[model samples]
Target: MAETMTTTQTITVGARRLEVSWAGVTHVGHRRETNQDSFLAEFPLFVVADGMGGHAGGEIASQSTVRRLHDVVDSADVGRSAIEGALERVVKDIAAHPETTDEGTGTTLTGVFIESDDEGSRWVALNIGDSRVYLLRDDHLVQVTTDHSVVQELITAGKLSPEEAEGHPYSNVITRAVGASELTPPDYVTIDVRAGDRFVVCSDGLTKELTDYGIQHFLRQHPTPGAAVDAMLAAALENGGRDNVSLIVVQVGDSSSTEDVHAE
Candidate 1:
């Protein structure tokens, strides 16, 4: 909760170039003793992790994952392999550290990274748990990542509705994680980049307080990344910051010529 962190830079990939502005923020919140979330928002990648466990293992799990991810992204062109390899290293990284637990320590990893293929530059969103990535384009907001939690499974199976799943007893139970996988790997979604695209990469902390409508309203009201991030965090805390909050707001410049994308 210092001054809002903001950065604007030009990133070049292949023959394509993008002017990007981003802001990142994290808070311990009103109910948590330690902030169990970590994030890395750099040129080619932006990721958020929410750690779970006792005995400081949660902090270690989240910190290690982001550190390894930062190491993996120390290159010009980032792709799916880099994220997979980094996650693979996360296992070893946790093993080497005695601060972690066998079954208790794990993390929810989610984020968006820039990927370049033969055609052109694009966005690749990845997720392993309940953390989320939302894209706002042409005034429409879409959650690009799926949740791996118990309530989500029930909702998918038609056993529970969205409103019913909100306060469910199993809402906090995640079926898969980076340390303990429930026989599933991370999910990936590749998106074509546009100049006006805006994304929200966040932990459940932020979503627990803000509705999809609230998120879209804030993004629409604040065009700059820093302003949007600040507004969202303030709103989350005001509603009731029951969990540690963390998020990164990212935007691509030069939106004058991009076509409007409909929510499908």
Candidate 2:
């Protein structure tokens, strides 16, 4: 069985109160015995982690990473430094875990966090592996994160086309990840936020079943975060969910109106 966690939050940034909401869900999929994926959809932080290694190790790696980030969010300080510090700790956490300290134990971390100041707000996206962050604005969709995978590298080198990389045996091989015996800081991108913008942070499990166009179609078909999430999950499952599926839908403001960044 799968579980969905939907949350609607209002965070005050400076003098402006921002209406930000997200809906998240995770499933083990048809082929997996256990769901090694984990996520955090709390205010100011929406992230997804895909654990790698064996069953227990994968779970530990993902949980350790997500739990550590949750601690940072709970600490009332959300920033690049805070996040990077927490992830650095996660490396130690995984290594410290007796059951999952093996070299094969690691997890891909990706997502976006809300950063606000007296001037307004923006989104900071971070990723360590193939998991992705996508943005939809003006009814257009774009992938905001570059995948860190061999297929991606091949595509970049012009040795493979995006279409040919779909099932290239190496499609699942990632270049970097947390708790992989090395400290690789996540790549960060700061995005300007708008009222009607929508963001999706998800594991490759979801992407494996949905193309970018399929994702865009569902997001437009369902307005609210929860509805969009439900639709995407169903479609993914119906389309032969071969791997664990996890996703988060973030909406910046009301659907009926266009808004701008503000601190009040």
Candidate 3:
């Protein structure tokens, strides 16, 4: 994988403005023959999708969803409703695709949508399946999206511990995903944005290799998104790289207040 690089962009809504620096990287990993993960890092939106299916179905599913989102975002029509509608359309399109019909092709979708109103700027975190969205604020990292996987349900039901779930055979069996069903709806939460907030949106590959503490350690050590993303990818690859790895790190703050940190 190449060294991670950061790109700065700004999101404005009404009278509110958010200066955002972000970086994204994806790898085929040590085991996978093909990369099935796809991502988007445009301003006002960031996404990570982990695809699953037989043959090329996984790749197709992930790419299709991201392309649809790119179109919707490029049209300047963005919001909870827009995202939901776009997902619905993508599902329909996938079902009608010759290669995906009856093949059970699907992809996990997770990320944040930036929105602004008269009050101020806010972030809407969205999720479907096991891919995750995490927030680092006040030096604390919190996972904002819940996984819709068998292991997650087992953990919630008190049938499994977090440590146990890590090695569970059903850990990869996601219960919900985009394009898996026409009725699948993503879970979302809207929260007020704060300066100095950092977000990590990633596939299960990274989490499978590192614990929350490990992730936070790198995030804190690498102050800039570029360095943080690179450090994370290197760690995951070193740990095992058992599956395709994809991630996007985003930091929000005033332009002058945030300093870019690069890895040597």
Candidate 4:
């Protein structure tokens, strides 16, 4: 097998009205021939999707979901409600598409949208299935979105312990996904924004490999968004990256404020 590799990409687009930096990484797992995950940082829109289906249907589903999301965002300036509506619309469209419908292709998407005005910026997270969004504030990590999957539900109902859920046979069987039905509702959460807060959007691959302690330590140590993303990906691979891993790290506030955040 070719040696597993990792790469990073960063873009600084738009005016300096606000400082925004994001980093993403995706790796084809040791066992898979094609990567079925996708991550995007389209300025105000950041998304991560883990696709499922047969053949290359998974890949096509994830890519199509991202493209469709971009289209919706492009046509309208959306708030939290609008974002949820867009997600619902996309899922319906995916279900209606003949090629995808017959194959039952679907994907889990966790998206974060940030908007800024003269006052400041606000953020909301939209999620379907198990991909996650975590917020880091004052050096503490908090899971902002609930997983819409069978194992997660079991854990919630106390039928399965956190440790047991990890190895469950149905751990990957998601109960909800975009395009799973004619219309699927995303669990959207509006989070209070603070200047020093940071957010991570990642596939289950990273969370599965790294403990919360490991993630918080690495993220706290590497303040640079790109560097943080790289370190997280490296650590996941080091711990037997059994699945494709992808992550995006974003920090709030201006560059100077971000420096202050890490200086603490």
Clashes of each: 0, 4, 0, 0
Per-residue lDDT tens digits for candidate 3, residues 1-264, read: 555889998766444576789999999999999999999988778999998887778887899889989987898877877888888878887787778846679899999877655666567888999999888987988898889999989999999999898889897899898875675778887756667889999999999898999889999999999899999999999999999999999998762223222111
| Residue ranges of candidate 3 with Cα displaced over 4 Å | 11-17, 101-103, 255-264
Query: Which should have the higher lDDT, number 1 or number 4?
Result: 1
**Model 2, range 1-264, lDDT digits (tens) per residue?**
343455778756545566787899888999999999999988889999999888698899999889999998999898888998998888888888889845489999999998877777678889999999999989899888889999999999999999999979999999989974768889888776666789999999999999999999999999888889988999999999999999999987743334532222
Write down the worst ten-residue block by lDDT for model 2. 255-264
C-alpha lDDT of candidate 4 relative to the true structure: 0.75
All candidates' lDDT scores?
Answer: 0.85, 0.87, 0.85, 0.75
What is residue 43's positional error in candidate 1, in angstroms? 1.0
Model 4 TM-score is 0.82
**What are the per-residue Cα lDDT tens digits for candidate 1 across 68-147?**
88887785546777777778788677666777776568899998887766766677788988999999987889998989
Q: Where does the lowest 10-residue lDDT sum fall in candidate 3? A: 255-264
TM-score of 2: 0.91
- Model 4 bad stretches (over 4 Å): 1-18, 80-89, 92-103, 115-121, 254-264
